[model samples]
Target: MSRATVHFLLRSDLERLFTTLTDNQYEIIGPTVKDGAVLYTPIQHSEQLPQGWQQLQAPGAYRMTRDNSQRYFAWANGPQALKPWLFAPREIIWQAERQPDGSLQFSEPAQPDRKLAFIGLRNCDLAALKLQDQHFLQGQYRDPYYAARRKGLLLIAVNCSHPADTCFCASTGDGPHAKADSEQPGFDLCLTELDDGFLVQSGSEPGDQLLEQLPVSPTTENQLHQQLQQALQAAKQQRALPSLPIKDLLAERRDHPQWDDIAERCLACGNCTQVCPTCFCHAEGEQVSLNSAVSEHTREWASCFSEGHGYMAGHQARPGIRERYQQWMTHKLSYWHDQYGRSGCTGCGRCTTWCPAAIDFPLEVSRICGDDE
Candidate 1:
């Protein structure tokens, strides 16, 4: 409500903000239409932001349509989120070269740290980002790549105005509006999309300083509340995960018949894991040159559903789809609490949206844990 903290930005003002980010040497990345989907790409201008285009997402379904509206950030989430940016899908951790003197030299690629500003971050994405930070930063072995990228990063979040049918971030308490508490800061700059303009708020010191440079007009408390009502109501989504913490309950139902039922429709193609915002499993291997002169150690995203994911002593622990599905579900709702002190799922519904076989995990969880009763 305060003039210094909250402001209104017109279309031209957004362009000015883009210009400011460029001048500050921040690589601006935002949502743009690519290959029939909204994807994060280098944004040079405000016009690159997906405008008048919205998505229809349901279980195992995603399609784009033109609504002829004058609003950006009016659609549900796409296939990806901030996970791929911070926790890269594929990265070379280190490399080794065979030496002439029968000794090997180990080296890492010297890619300079980049100052990145990610725009159009959703509330669920912000929640997912927090979980990612916990995984990569709070662990015994902090990932240098994630730590370096996260340090100089700026997040410009957009409040959800168009939650999809598959979304359940509300039930997860992550929600339509991103929460920034005294303990943990959320986004750098948060925006609520409106028809004529955007309602902006600074969530961090950097955001405050950045907003000072933008061409934004002061907004009143009444105006802010009135406009924010719709975004808050967007949290009342059609889908919701169980409100209760079924961590222990899910573990007890390891042999639930529901697993078999869901597995029949599941292809175990790992589509859900790949699209999920918080799934963090990865496969690491060494890539050796044909001449044995060079070796590169790489880490790439992996899924529990992968046949090789549960390999131990030349035998697959979860070779069947039912076991794999059970493992994925339990880790998300049960094991995550033990690991991160909270659920791993952000309820962005990307897994539900992109799963080719239409395996709706939320409904499946209810059925498996007997929460539907």
Candidate 2:
């Protein structure tokens, strides 16, 4: 946690880091360009990382372009976050079988048997992971599946130096820079990629052990200063949220015309929730065998925009797109504060960048609250 413990890692040594993780039997999952978009995927070597590639993102727009710069993680974020790695999109909770005596037997599914070392995790996404932990791990009834996957998870957080057009972590206090401490429920190691090398700090005991195995030199004060400056510059470059209190603004503006305005532009396709790192809604169903002798209960990711999401016994509460949109926004911006003592959104801007409608929530908030400045 001390600045004295920070170290410098040369660009060439990145391969060594990956090798070390692989030697420790950790599956290395990091960012790579695939199918014209930056996505988190499995990587065996450091070369698999999307180096010198940057992304241009806007409302309803995303394009990958070459940056010519030697930076490895210049792009702020990709479509995937730490969510899927922890909370699987689809998982079988339990299965049941017909016994020999015509009785039913049920058992929980086996947990995944892999230790994951997640690389290129941004600070905002890291915060989202903690928020998810609050929901799945810290609840009265803990989610066994999520807990099992989270147990051996190692987070390697990257400090943001290149923010996207829609990013606003600066306003949400989630991040443009990773928190420089290990005591928090965040990354095991925090990395700041510089022109020539990376400024690395251990946030956990495993991170310290990994650092011990790597070829690294003590970081200089000048390098640390530059790291801080770059992070601050990234924060400055990101879009700023409205000056008004967001929770209060949304709470009082339930009847505001902005909901209707957004509904008009919103496709209700649920792309935002799907890409959002913090959205944890899911639906469970039981699948029966043809003979109805065996059944498997499975849970998969669900969206608030789904028409059935608001259905009751005989009626639907949010039958209209406007109500569905309102529910999504209000739950993210206002109700989440009451439930978790924090806003649900991390300001990572994935929703805006990937949305077909290009509906930027921060811009919408600014317009709704009349905070032009």
Candidate 3:
């Protein structure tokens, strides 16, 4: 394929090309700050990044100030999401040791201690990592620990140029700018932070071998139309609402009375699908043995607003709290776009800033789609 042209690195050669890609072992990841928020860990240099920080979300706040500006896509969506370090809220997947003559060995759970690169990544977190690469790596049930951390990761994307006031990603088409044909070619360097430096591109083949190992330059069709007119006027001044056919209003809000007046200020509290960067749901457990020898089988991160994720056999399938907040806001604004054709809300509002009751999904979707004025 062709489109990979714009390139230019200087921000001190993109911090010596990410400290020589973290001295070649890769693991980098990015955005920092911790505890008082901002997250997306694993940094080890560039002075543990986040210098001067810049968070500031809304609807049930999240602050963090200062922005001395080393520009990395300034700020927006935080409260930690990038989906629990690529889909992991807990894991163990295998272990069964027993034996002294009874026999039971098992094993199987090592791979993944970091090889990634990540960095800055946004654009509704690369459209929620292509919706968890279509539910656990091209679905049909495959998930080998998210396909070995999605094949030892690399993506570097970034391109958001700020948009948060509960951003709407221009109404779910996905993001305040990041489209040069995205589709899980999980970027191997895509940056944008314009104004004078990074507009790099490359997509695969290890982002053309990490752009033949950086220090790149060539980009002048008026600096690639001024970084695509500052990522389309910062996604048209960060558009906020008006777009909710949410797959035909989640196939006509199954018995909607505004889900019982938004379930009395909803608090089934799955902190908006755990700060959804595209919730993938999870849960599994087992950790036996004390001399029967050993046992372990794990998986965490789950919630249709918890309640034993609908326990079973004796019943629990959505038993109030307004039916698990109307099945997680109608499977995220409508049957997750009728079972994933898209629109599972990448409007990165970090679910109204970690919803402690700021429950404002665009003012409950304009009180059930009606007042967009």
Candidate 4:
């Protein structure tokens, strides 16, 4: 439909699009080859992308190769997601200065620049964003820091042109394509890369506004069909992950042996939770002036896998490594939906890829559910 849909040839017109975006003073963040890994980084132009390059990844393994395809998103999910930029690694709470009179003055942390436009966002990441919005934005106690950084940011989602070995987004019912419509718009612009071109559509008012600047033609019937075909093709290649009724499974496996096995290999490390886009858990701390004149509170990212995360009143609730892992998994895969009306895990596969033990989640589920007998 010409009303809001448009198409552009991927090879010829994509660079122009990037140039147009930069012209608007938007800091474009996209995939680039850095230190032999596909990292989401800043790019001055489209030349910085992994042209004719793609990555094949699985638990404990990630490799790059030339695909001979110029698709901007030919590769699957990368190691680092888009969360680090949006949700900072660390932020100063407030700075305080003491005066000669022993009085102290405090200043709040600086907010993020408002003109960042994220490109190559996947469906799983989008779902993760939704989960974070529920926790940080819609909650009774809104996080002013997160709220300020999240506002006025532009989302440029790309449909998965290739599904990775570790991905199970379809099992989570969030994958390959952006499913939300006008009332529930998830992105500003959705790009589906075709063999020679891209199928572009605007999902929100801002998206429509952005689209007007690019040289996009009305989406023809054939392009629409091609878009569906590409999506279905990616979907068909998805590995069949078992649909474990998470709530029931978790309820029965409170003391399962899998916890012990996982702990033995897990290192009690929090890499999975840290890399996860949907993880919103954090802990707060305070710093006081030397003269006790002023105090400033700070919030830092926390994880369930950490030794001190469950600590309360000098006693940690889940002491054992097994117990902590169980709690994290149970909350993420099962109880999170009940508490927040959405699943905590977005099937982004960053957990498996980044874990030292190469912990395959689907394999874990299979172990818990038992194999075909």
Task: Give the runs in model 2 whose Cα sits over 4 Å from its true position.
Answer: 1-4, 371-373
Model 3 root-mean-square deviation: 16.0
Which 10-residue window in model 4 sums to the lowest lDDT?
1-10
As for lDDT, the candidate ahead, 1 or 3, is 1
Cα lDDT tens digits, model 2, 23-54, are: 99999999999999888888989888889999
TM-score of 3: 0.41
Compare candidates 3 and 4 on TM-score and give the better one: 4
lDDT of 4 by residue, 108-181 (tens): 97777668788888888888888888887898988777888788778888899788877778778778677755
**Tens digit of per-residue lDDT, candidate 1, span 1-373:** 3323668888657888899999999999999989999998888998998899888999889998887888888887889978888888999999999999989999998765899999999988988988998889999999888888888889999888889899998888888777754445488898887767888888877888788888888777766886668766897898888665589889887767788898898999999899888988999999999999999999999999998999999888998999999899899989999999998888899989999998887988888767553
The segments of candidate 3 whose C-alpha lies over 4 angstroms from its true place after superposition are: 1-85, 88-94, 101-108, 117-122, 126-154, 158-167, 170-198, 201-212, 218-221, 228-230, 237-256, 260-281, 287-295, 305-321, 326-364, 368-373
Error of 3 at 223 (Å): 1.7
Sliding window of 10 residues with minimal summed lDDT for model 3: 237-246
Q: How many pairs collide in each candidate, listed in order? A: 0, 1, 0, 0
User: What is residue 260's positional error in candidate 4, in angstroms?
Assistant: 1.8
Is 2 or 4 the stronger prediction by lDDT? 2
What's the TM-score of each model vs. the native?
Answer: 0.95, 0.95, 0.41, 0.91
Residue 367 local lDDT, model 1 = 82
lDDT of 3 by residue, 207-314 (tens): 777777788877778777877787777676333655556556545656657767778887787887877878888888887877657889888889897888977898
